[model samples]
Target: VRPKFIDYYCPYTLGGHFINACNKDGEPVCGIYVKVSVERLNDISEQDAIAEGIDTDWLAESQDNYDCIADHNMSGRPTAKGHFSYLWQSIYGDDKSKCWEKNPWVWVIEFKRVQEQRND
Candidate 1:
């Protein structure tokens, strides 16, 4: 799960039992596991979609389907939910086990961004 991917994506260093980390560039970064759950991709709600960061202007972490943000929404979504759908589809469209049309059960991780701390 996150343990497999966090290293590749975040690249941090641990601070002993103190539980701290920094990036490859030595810029301090820290995160603690908040929570993780499983849900159908299609069951995502507006609040969850917003929490996924669609409203903040970042559509998807790997989003290249920007047109869907506004244009696809005209098809009856028109909100954070719409953006999230596009993101999900983009990320998991190839495999039936992860496909949006299949409404696959996906691990949902909730992270709360806090104020930056030292590079400890």
Candidate 2:
């Protein structure tokens, strides 16, 4: 088995300048709006081990819930809307605030197969 790498398109926007009532010019916006490409190593522990010339049995098993969150131990980033929190709250009755505080590391949204693979 080979390691199946997955790509995620993460759309993010930074805080932009606010409109000032006194200023006649439009609000000076100074922020970043961009998409980030995130990659995930597929559930191929045994394959990875074999390819790396290491013992396969010792590798840790992958979790069924494939999404990974950003937290202190992990990515350490805030959970954005329409990503992890939204899904968790909808499915598990887990609020975004609670998820963020409790298990931020695993509070990510899984990529839809079609969205991730982009198969036509």
Candidate that would win on TM-score: 1
Candidate number of the best lDDT? 1
**For model 1, the run of ten residues with the poorest summed lDDT:** 1-10
What TM-score, over all chains together, does every model reach? Answer: 0.51, 0.18
Q: Over the stretch 1-120, how does candidate 2's per-residue lDDT look in tens digits? A: 222233443244223523233223433223333433433323223343254343223222334223433222334332222133334454555444464335432221233232122237
The TM-score of predicted model 1 comes to: 0.51
Candidate 1 lDDT by residue in tens digits, 1-120: 111223333335433323335555665566566998999878989898887667644444435544775556445335677777777777757445546677778898877665765578
* After superposition, candidate 1 runs with Cα above 4 Å error: 1-29, 56-77, 94-98, 117-120
lDDT of 1 at 95: 42
Alpha-carbon lDDT, every model:
0.63, 0.33
Q: How many backbone clashes does every candidate have?
A: 1, 1
The candidate 2 region of ten consecutive residues with least summed lDDT is 107-116
Candidate 1 residue pairs in backbone clash = 13-22
